[model samples]
Target: MTRPPLAVIAGTGFYDLEALEDRVEESIDTRWGPARVTRGSWHGLPVVFLTRHGPGHSVPPHLVNYRANIRALADLGCEDVLAVNVTGSIDPGLVPGDLLCLDDFLDLTRQRPLTFFDGSGPEGVVHVDVTTPYHPALRRELLEAAVAAGHPLRDGGVYAAFEGPRFETAAEIRLARLAGGDVAGMTGVPEVVLAREAGLRYAAVALVVNPCTGVGDSEEPITMEDIEAVLATSREAVLAVLDELVHTRATFTEEGTG
Candidate 1:
């Protein structure tokens, strides 16, 4: 069977790629660790899906094996990756259910391993240019897909990634906004950075599930129930975008080959 050329990294409640056809599980081993990946077909194009938070959504952001996940996808011949992140809007303009194609990121994570280049790896102490963190070509395709799907999508935004099992406090949200972040989430940083280090084209479609701690008029504090409720309602939008993304990947590959 032909290996998949594109991979999707799913987050939060979205652990499986529902749009994929003829799916099969493949376990991939890398120097860092092993990642179990799902290989499948979408619209006759090969695709791979990896649940960033695992199948049962048991892994926390801080504990996710970012390096292993990126390495596994790269090893599977995936040249491009589309990462879906569920985020909270730091800017009022970015409302719940808005899809944001992130252009930049601010890493607020404290203890996760961020790079593939250890002293023993292929390149020692090498730096990859992150001036434009998300791949421009992929970003364009994502925006076009959003338009075709008739979804509310922002062309670009800055995502701030924090270390978390807990949601950010209002003070922290304000601080992130001051730091030039448009959206706030826990999982976008090391994954995007790791993909770049693995030499794969990457872009993130961030689904804003709620207003960040201080952005909207809420009588009470943000809770797990509230977040889950918003996510449940916005789940359809996420699925719609994924369908568009799969089609976009097919188009991109066909054009590249032709």
Candidate 2:
């Protein structure tokens, strides 16, 4: 059996993976739009790395072309996607720099292209089932890898996706918490949804950058500087987990036992 390359999507402070060798940048054109990605190999496994925010973080959350990104990855023969999202903690106990493998989500976005199926395609109107939005096997692998790497990762978390370039308000965070949200982010929605629509195994690991408004004792407002500082410190830890996961996969493939 042939294994497809792993697709990794990330935003905010993760511009490139230094461990990736022989990198080649490409612009993939899809029906929705053009998406940029880097092709490389990591730990003897092919990888497709995409920065959702574009180079230099030029694109904002609400403006991301979710359909194009997802389509491009699918078109490139990627069967599994690993997403890393920087988020604010809605759970009061989750402090900054905590990592969680998200199991569910609440979409609060008002506007954006949410699907590839518009009833125009030959498949007609399609409503893909998201009973398990994040692929269970992939999530398990991530958790195991994190543990093996000696990094503590919360197994299950609910990610609340809000439409924004702006941070959420206290009332909004409270509402999300009421709905069982553990973390809040701006870009996890349609991306995850589209991956499901495309028949790709998808999972996400969220890095908590700060506490959402009114969640913790910090009355201070969220700032880019604060988020960046945490990202800078925690990026290595996140990458280590990914490395462990991919290395394990490579080893299993070599042994013909995965």
Candidate 3:
């Protein structure tokens, strides 16, 4: 039996892929808690979608159940995950309209469990290697898809994950950039970590929605709604890249069977 090709975990303002067909909203229970998953077909590819926040976008970054989300998908026989995250740019040129293929991450999250091995879930502590944080093959597919779609996607960048319901300060942004952070966001840390632990091929497509606090005019305050609105600008690119990745996988699967 062939399992589904991929599952998407949408972040922040991205709730679900609206182009999905033959969809059903599923409620899944894991060791962590209840999570809602959208089971459907997108571009004729069997896929599942899960919103990181909730149906209402109420869960804050610190409070999100990363364990349950990944666990549910893995339990459902899903082997690969595409995480769509909205981020702030740390680089000078990567403005609000660019997309980044996240290859590495600097996790600055405080109090979030960095690993699934708490000496209880699995024997001892299974130290999974994160030398290559993002799956290289998956990143390549995403990049090819983005370029083919005529979208400007940075081939590789380091994501700095912040534990936030609040945006970073100027000093923090500066420090982040100095530490090799190309993009900054709230939830990339443990999600990437746990996905590696789950042995699932995972990759992230980061959409830059605004300049980091210090990179641009640091004093100007931005609303969450304002950040969300920027996603609309790259909405087509995001959808197209996702389609390309899924369709590309489906094509390979078909060829291998033939």
Candidate 4:
């Protein structure tokens, strides 16, 4: 009955962690709101797992309550938060099925709430530094785990976050690359920022689900079918990395990047 100090925040289609022992649902309340989190143990290590998109993939990206999720984990004493993002490949080399440990990000989301401080924080005018938004030590630990688990993981990439229930346009894809984005995804921005502000060591591993609006093998426009197919093919890779990370805790330290 020991509580796991690690938190894994993944997408909906990826559900490998459901197999954890003694898994139970818990309602976590935060200053922003409440978040539903799953508590479980893997290899005797406690893990708190939650999907960025809710069960059955019903929740849209822009609608995700990033603050509540991060706050809930922080309140639960989770020190390391690992986010598994499904991204569109902007780099040709980072094609579908490839896993990349993100090093940076570009926020193009205009509609989502970007911070936890809006005169409602514990301290007034709280300024959290995000010079290195993603924690390096944690990323290195995940990269090592991915390789050890037999998954070929790219060491680094920049994930661009788009405000979307809808996918980005081809023109936007072009703009993403110009802005130094290696891949694009709907989630990853506010979640990451919130985690940093919450004092949790955060890292993300991206599974390239498809090309951005116009960067893949197909000359035709990207569709839901294409992404679905990519996801189907990537299910195993996703399962492997996640299982390995949880079982081993990916060699992450509780001290974090402080």
lDDT of each: 0.86, 0.95, 0.86, 0.83
Candidate 2 per-residue lDDT over residues 51-100, each given as its tens digit: 99999999999999999999999999999999999999999999988999
Error of 2 at 73 (Å): 0.6
User: How good is model 1 by TM-score?
Assistant: 0.93
Clashing pairs in 2: none
- The candidate, 1 or 3, that scores higher on lDDT is 1
- What would the per-residue lDDT of candidate 3 be over residues 120-168, giving only the tens digit for each residue? 8647778788999899988888999887777878889999999998999
Provide the TM-score for each candidate, comma-separated.
Answer: 0.93, 0.98, 0.95, 0.91
Question: Sorted on lDDT, highest at the top, how do the candidates line up?
Answer: 2, 1, 3, 4
For model 3, name the residue pairs that clash: none
Model 2 local distance difference test score: 0.95
Q: Which residues of candidate 1, in runs, are more than 4 Å off? A: 1-4, 248-258
Clashing pairs in 4: 4-46
Which residue ranges in model 3 land beyond 4 Å of their true spot? Answer: 255-258
Deviation from native of the Cα of residue 86 in model 1, angstroms: 0.2
RMSD of each: 2.2, 1.3, 1.5, 3.6
